[model samples]
Target: MDIPAALGGVSTALTIVKQLNDIDRRVDEAGFKLRIAEATSALAEAKLGLVDAQEDIRSKEAEISSLRSLLKRKEETVERSGYRYRCDANKNPIGTALCPVCMDEGRFVLTIQSDQSGRPYVCPKCKANFGYLSAFQDP
Candidate 1:
Protein backbone atom coordinates (compact mmCIF):
# COMPACT_ATOMS: atom_id res chain seq x y z
CA MET A 1 0.00 0.00 0.00
CA ASP A 2 1.11 3.66 0.46
CA ILE A 3 4.14 4.26 2.79
CA PRO A 4 2.52 6.93 5.06
CA ALA A 5 -0.64 4.80 5.56
CA ALA A 6 1.43 1.75 6.50
CA LEU A 7 3.37 3.75 9.12
CA GLY A 8 0.09 5.11 10.60
CA GLY A 9 -1.32 1.53 11.02
CA VAL A 10 1.91 0.42 12.78
CA SER A 11 1.65 3.38 15.17
CA THR A 12 -2.00 2.52 16.05
CA ALA A 13 -1.04 -1.12 16.83
CA LEU A 14 1.77 -0.01 19.17
CA THR A 15 -0.59 2.36 21.04
CA ILE A 16 -3.14 -0.46 21.65
CA VAL A 17 -0.42 -2.76 23.04
CA LYS A 18 0.80 -0.08 25.46
CA GLN A 19 -2.74 0.51 26.80
CA LEU A 20 -3.24 -3.24 27.42
CA ASN A 21 0.06 -3.47 29.37
CA ASP A 22 -1.01 -0.61 31.65
CA ILE A 23 -4.38 -2.32 32.40
CA ASP A 24 -2.59 -5.61 33.28
CA ARG A 25 -0.23 -3.88 35.71
CA ARG A 26 -3.13 -2.10 37.49
CA VAL A 27 -5.06 -5.40 37.87
CA ASP A 28 -2.01 -7.12 39.49
CA GLU A 29 -1.54 -4.24 41.97
CA ALA A 30 -5.23 -4.37 43.04
CA GLY A 31 -5.03 -8.12 43.71
CA PHE A 32 -1.95 -7.67 45.89
CA LYS A 33 -3.63 -4.93 48.00
CA LEU A 34 -6.74 -7.08 48.60
CA ARG A 35 -4.63 -9.98 49.90
CA ILE A 36 -2.85 -7.67 52.38
CA ALA A 37 -6.21 -6.44 53.79
CA GLU A 38 -7.49 -9.97 54.40
CA ALA A 39 -4.31 -10.99 56.22
CA THR A 40 -4.50 -7.96 58.52
CA SER A 41 -8.08 -8.79 59.53
CA ALA A 42 -7.16 -12.38 60.39
CA LEU A 43 -4.26 -11.25 62.59
CA ALA A 44 -6.52 -8.87 64.56
CA GLU A 45 -9.02 -11.64 65.29
CA ALA A 46 -6.26 -13.91 66.60
CA LYS A 47 -5.05 -11.19 69.00
CA LEU A 48 -8.57 -10.83 70.47
CA GLY A 49 -8.76 -14.57 71.13
CA LEU A 50 -5.46 -14.47 73.01
CA VAL A 51 -6.71 -11.67 75.27
CA ASP A 52 -9.84 -13.69 76.17
CA ALA A 53 -7.80 -16.74 77.11
CA GLN A 54 -5.61 -14.67 79.44
CA GLU A 55 -8.68 -13.28 81.29
CA ASP A 56 -10.04 -16.80 81.83
CA ILE A 57 -6.76 -17.93 83.35
CA ARG A 58 -6.70 -15.00 85.79
CA SER A 59 -10.21 -15.77 87.06
CA LYS A 60 -9.34 -19.41 87.69
CA GLU A 61 -6.28 -18.42 89.72
CA ALA A 62 -8.41 -16.15 91.96
CA GLU A 63 -10.83 -18.99 92.70
CA ILE A 64 -7.99 -21.32 93.66
CA SER A 65 -6.60 -18.76 96.13
CA SER A 66 -9.98 -18.39 97.86
CA LEU A 67 -10.33 -22.16 98.27
CA ARG A 68 -6.86 -22.37 99.85
CA SER A 69 -7.77 -19.78 102.49
CA LEU A 70 -10.89 -21.71 103.50
CA LEU A 71 -8.91 -24.93 103.89
CA LYS A 72 -6.41 -23.20 106.24
CA ARG A 73 -9.21 -21.99 108.53
CA LYS A 74 -10.68 -25.49 108.81
CA GLU A 75 -7.27 -26.90 109.76
CA GLU A 76 -6.85 -24.37 112.56
CA THR A 77 -10.24 -25.26 114.08
CA VAL A 78 -9.37 -28.99 114.09
CA GLU A 79 -6.04 -28.37 115.84
CA ARG A 80 -7.65 -26.30 118.61
CA SER A 81 -9.99 -29.06 119.81
CA GLY A 82 -9.86 -32.29 117.87
CA TYR A 83 -11.69 -34.74 120.19
CA ARG A 84 -13.93 -32.52 122.32
CA TYR A 85 -17.12 -34.45 121.51
CA ARG A 86 -18.00 -37.34 123.90
CA CYS A 87 -21.33 -38.70 122.64
CA ASP A 88 -23.38 -41.18 124.73
CA ALA A 89 -25.51 -44.05 123.44
CA ASN A 90 -28.39 -41.78 122.43
CA LYS A 91 -25.95 -39.56 120.40
CA ASN A 92 -26.10 -36.94 123.15
CA PRO A 93 -22.75 -35.23 123.67
CA ILE A 94 -21.31 -34.82 127.21
CA GLY A 95 -18.86 -31.95 127.93
CA THR A 96 -15.15 -32.72 128.19
CA ALA A 97 -12.90 -31.20 130.85
CA LEU A 98 -10.99 -28.93 128.42
CA CYS A 99 -9.28 -26.10 130.27
CA PRO A 100 -10.21 -22.73 128.72
CA VAL A 101 -6.93 -21.19 129.95
CA CYS A 102 -4.63 -23.38 127.79
CA MET A 103 -7.10 -23.37 124.89
CA ASP A 104 -6.55 -19.64 124.40
CA GLU A 105 -2.91 -20.47 123.67
CA GLY A 106 -3.88 -23.14 121.09
CA ARG A 107 -3.16 -26.10 123.40
CA PHE A 108 -5.65 -28.96 123.99
CA VAL A 109 -5.08 -29.81 127.66
CA LEU A 110 -7.90 -31.76 129.34
CA THR A 111 -8.75 -31.54 133.02
CA ILE A 112 -8.67 -35.03 134.61
CA GLN A 113 -11.66 -34.41 136.91
CA SER A 114 -14.32 -31.89 137.84
CA ASP A 115 -16.10 -30.85 141.10
CA GLN A 116 -19.07 -32.93 142.34
CA SER A 117 -21.61 -30.61 140.66
CA GLY A 118 -19.53 -30.65 137.35
CA ARG A 119 -18.55 -26.98 137.72
CA PRO A 120 -15.07 -25.49 138.12
CA TYR A 121 -13.20 -28.08 136.02
CA VAL A 122 -9.50 -28.16 136.98
CA CYS A 123 -6.72 -29.02 134.48
CA PRO A 124 -3.71 -30.83 135.87
CA LYS A 125 -1.50 -30.18 132.85
CA CYS A 126 -1.44 -26.38 133.18
CA LYS A 127 -2.95 -26.05 136.71
CA ALA A 128 -5.95 -24.02 135.50
CA ASN A 129 -9.68 -24.05 136.24
CA PHE A 130 -12.67 -23.45 133.89
CA GLY A 131 -16.46 -23.64 133.94
CA TYR A 132 -18.38 -26.39 132.09
CA LEU A 133 -18.84 -25.52 128.39
CA SER A 134 -21.87 -26.66 126.36
CA ALA A 135 -21.66 -29.86 124.32
CA PHE A 136 -22.57 -28.02 121.07
CA GLN A 137 -19.25 -26.15 120.81
CA ASP A 138 -17.23 -27.67 117.91
CA PRO A 139 -16.93 -31.34 117.03
Candidate 2:
Protein backbone atom coordinates (compact mmCIF):
# COMPACT_ATOMS: atom_id res chain seq x y z
CA MET A 1 0.00 0.00 0.00
CA ASP A 2 2.97 2.29 0.51
CA ILE A 3 3.76 4.59 -2.45
CA PRO A 4 7.35 3.52 -2.70
CA ALA A 5 6.39 -0.18 -2.88
CA ALA A 6 3.84 0.60 -5.55
CA LEU A 7 6.40 2.48 -7.63
CA GLY A 8 8.87 -0.37 -7.15
CA GLY A 9 6.30 -2.85 -8.47
CA VAL A 10 5.77 -0.74 -11.60
CA SER A 11 9.51 -0.45 -12.09
CA THR A 12 9.89 -4.23 -11.75
CA ALA A 13 7.17 -4.84 -14.34
CA LEU A 14 8.81 -2.45 -16.80
CA THR A 15 12.19 -4.14 -16.36
CA ILE A 16 10.62 -7.53 -17.01
CA VAL A 17 8.96 -6.25 -20.17
CA LYS A 18 12.27 -4.85 -21.48
CA GLN A 19 14.02 -8.13 -20.72
CA LEU A 20 11.35 -10.08 -22.54
CA ASN A 21 11.76 -7.85 -25.60
CA ASP A 22 15.51 -8.35 -25.65
CA ILE A 23 15.25 -12.16 -25.48
CA ASP A 24 16.21 -14.00 -28.72
CA ARG A 25 14.04 -16.71 -30.32
CA ARG A 26 16.54 -19.32 -28.99
CA VAL A 27 15.54 -18.52 -25.34
CA ASP A 28 14.23 -21.59 -23.47
CA GLU A 29 10.45 -21.88 -22.91
CA ALA A 30 10.75 -22.46 -19.14
CA GLY A 31 12.85 -19.28 -18.62
CA PHE A 32 10.31 -17.18 -20.58
CA LYS A 33 7.43 -18.61 -18.53
CA LEU A 34 9.19 -17.64 -15.28
CA ARG A 35 9.72 -14.04 -16.47
CA ILE A 36 6.04 -13.78 -17.50
CA ALA A 37 4.93 -14.95 -14.05
CA GLU A 38 7.20 -12.42 -12.34
CA ALA A 39 5.76 -9.61 -14.47
CA THR A 40 2.21 -10.68 -13.57
CA SER A 41 3.02 -10.59 -9.84
CA ALA A 42 4.61 -7.14 -10.12
CA LEU A 43 1.60 -5.75 -11.98
CA ALA A 44 -0.73 -7.14 -9.30
CA GLU A 45 1.25 -5.38 -6.56
CA ALA A 46 1.02 -2.08 -8.47
CA LYS A 47 -2.76 -2.51 -8.83
CA LEU A 48 -3.14 -3.04 -5.05
CA GLY A 49 -1.13 0.13 -4.39
CA LEU A 50 -3.43 2.12 -6.68
CA VAL A 51 -6.48 0.79 -4.83
CA ASP A 52 -5.05 1.76 -1.42
CA ALA A 53 -4.19 5.27 -2.67
CA GLN A 54 -7.76 5.73 -3.90
CA GLU A 55 -9.11 4.66 -0.50
CA ASP A 56 -6.86 7.16 1.27
CA ILE A 57 -8.10 9.94 -1.00
CA ARG A 58 -11.72 9.07 -0.23
CA SER A 59 -11.09 9.05 3.54
CA LYS A 60 -9.48 12.50 3.40
CA GLU A 61 -12.37 13.88 1.36
CA ALA A 62 -14.87 12.68 3.94
CA GLU A 63 -12.87 14.31 6.76
CA ILE A 64 -12.79 17.61 4.88
CA SER A 65 -16.55 17.52 4.33
CA SER A 66 -17.17 16.94 8.05
CA LEU A 67 -14.87 19.81 9.06
CA ARG A 68 -16.60 22.13 6.60
CA SER A 69 -19.96 21.29 8.14
CA LEU A 70 -18.65 22.10 11.64
CA LEU A 71 -17.18 25.40 10.41
CA LYS A 72 -20.55 26.37 8.87
CA ARG A 73 -22.28 25.69 12.19
CA LYS A 74 -19.71 27.77 14.07
CA GLU A 75 -20.22 30.63 11.65
CA GLU A 76 -23.99 30.49 12.27
CA THR A 77 -23.43 31.30 15.96
CA VAL A 78 -23.89 34.88 17.22
CA GLU A 79 -22.27 36.97 19.93
CA ARG A 80 -24.53 39.40 21.81
CA SER A 81 -24.48 41.31 25.12
CA GLY A 82 -21.05 39.87 26.03
CA TYR A 83 -22.29 36.30 25.51
CA ARG A 84 -22.30 33.82 22.65
CA TYR A 85 -25.39 31.95 21.44
CA ARG A 86 -26.22 29.55 18.70
CA CYS A 87 -28.75 30.81 16.15
CA ASP A 88 -31.66 29.13 14.48
CA ALA A 89 -32.13 28.90 10.71
CA ASN A 90 -34.06 32.18 10.93
CA LYS A 91 -31.00 33.78 12.64
CA ASN A 92 -32.84 34.08 15.96
CA PRO A 93 -30.75 33.36 19.05
CA ILE A 94 -31.60 30.12 20.83
CA GLY A 95 -30.43 28.08 23.87
CA THR A 96 -28.50 29.21 26.99
CA ALA A 97 -25.74 31.78 26.88
CA LEU A 98 -22.26 30.50 26.05
CA CYS A 99 -19.06 31.66 27.71
CA PRO A 100 -17.68 34.64 25.76
CA VAL A 101 -14.10 33.85 26.76
CA CYS A 102 -14.29 30.27 25.47
CA MET A 103 -16.00 31.42 22.27
CA ASP A 104 -13.31 34.05 21.66
CA GLU A 105 -10.66 31.33 21.99
CA GLY A 106 -12.47 29.24 19.34
CA ARG A 107 -13.28 26.60 21.94
CA PHE A 108 -16.46 24.56 21.97
CA VAL A 109 -19.59 26.26 23.26
CA LEU A 110 -19.38 26.25 27.07
CA THR A 111 -22.71 27.38 28.46
CA ILE A 112 -22.54 30.09 31.16
CA GLN A 113 -24.05 29.16 34.50
CA SER A 114 -26.59 31.63 35.92
CA ASP A 115 -27.93 32.29 39.40
CA GLN A 116 -31.58 31.49 40.30
CA SER A 117 -32.43 35.07 39.26
CA GLY A 118 -31.33 34.25 35.68
CA ARG A 119 -28.48 36.72 35.94
CA PRO A 120 -25.05 36.07 34.41
CA TYR A 121 -22.87 34.54 37.14
CA VAL A 122 -20.02 32.26 36.03
CA CYS A 123 -18.93 29.87 33.32
CA PRO A 124 -18.87 26.21 34.38
CA LYS A 125 -16.38 25.28 31.67
CA CYS A 126 -13.77 28.04 31.97
CA LYS A 127 -14.79 29.10 35.50
CA ALA A 128 -14.92 32.77 34.47
CA ASN A 129 -16.89 34.94 36.91
CA PHE A 130 -19.23 37.65 35.67
CA GLY A 131 -19.84 39.26 39.02
CA TYR A 132 -22.88 41.41 39.89
CA LEU A 133 -24.33 42.43 36.53
CA SER A 134 -27.29 44.54 37.72
CA ALA A 135 -28.35 45.57 34.19
CA PHE A 136 -27.72 42.28 32.35
CA GLN A 137 -30.36 39.59 32.95
CA ASP A 138 -30.94 36.38 30.99
CA PRO A 139 -34.31 36.34 29.25
Question: TM-scores of the models, in the given order?
Answer: 0.38, 0.62
Q: Which lDDT tens digits does candidate 1 get at residues 36-116?
A: 454455445445555665676788789788667745533433222443433444545445535556655555566654656
Clashes (backbone N, CA, C under 3 Å), per candidate, total 0, 0
Candidate 2, poorest ten consecutive residues by summed lDDT: 130-139
Model 1 TM-score (2 dp): 0.38
Q: lDDT winner among the candidates?
A: 2
Off by over 4 Å in 2: 79-84, 87-139
Query: Which residue pairs of candidate 1 clash?
Result: none
Q: Encode model 2's per-residue lDDT on 7-56: one tens digit a residue.
A: 98999999998898776637677777888899999999988998898888
